[model samples]
Target: MKKNKTMVEIWQDVVEIKDLIRSIILSFIFTFGVYLFVSPNNKAKELFFGLVGAVMGFVITNVFIKPKRIIIFDKNKIKE
Candidate 1:
């Protein structure tokens, strides 16, 4: 069965609304979760940890979620 996708344009890019929301939630969770582990007194540490968290979130999101788009190449467009 083919499932219909609900896509929307945000900042001139089209994305599935559901996936966008999921990405937001997951990134927030990972960012905040890791941020919480660092001591509150050190601002630099917090920033570093938060950035690491964001990267982790990006990687995890990519791992679990597949891209909804496909690219097609025109053979005639590129001639060797």
Candidate 2:
């Protein structure tokens, strides 16, 4: 028999996947940004710096922006 999962659980899975994709994009952007900064003629150096920047961006975002916000809801106002 298979267990059923709630909508919230499905949403959470989607959110996790989105986060993973975002991290990859962020890393790629960072790498490109670093390459622009270096302005190196050699492709190898540019790639190296870009990779470093990508890793840096990914780490920074994960460390500082991954936390969730807390909000409280009031039921009294809605129960007219």
Candidate 3:
């Protein structure tokens, strides 16, 4: 008999730690860039919102983004 897999089980394989980390880092960089452009005069506000942006970025990417899959098809093969 085969066992049924739950949604969580299926998703566990799809979610990756590296991707999460990358997303968080990217968010930090983006937030910093925006901060520089906006020139927030308060250091406390900058630090606090940067942290928030990082966490939000991680969660959003993890929940909504999936790794891309690449597939190659060859049409030149001949059947004997």
Best model number under lDDT: 1
State the lDDT of candidate 1 residue by residue for 1-80, as single tens digits. Answer: 23887888787777888888899899998998889975375889889899889889999999977776687886776658
Ranking by TM-score: 1, 2, 3
TM-score quality measure for candidate 1: 0.80
Worst 10-residue lDDT window, candidate 3: 1-10
Candidate 2, residue 35: how far the Cα is off, in Å: 1.6
In model 1, the runs with Cα more than 4 Å from the true position are 77-80
RMSD of each: 2.5, 10.5, 10.6
Q: How do the predictions measure up, each by TM-score?
A: 0.80, 0.48, 0.38
Candidate 2 CA-lDDT value: 0.65
Pairs that collide in candidate 2 are: none
Candidate 1 lDDT score at position 21: 88
Provide backbone clash counts, one per model: 0, 0, 0
- Residue 48's lDDT within candidate 3 is 73
Q: Which residue pairs collide in model 3, if any?
A: none
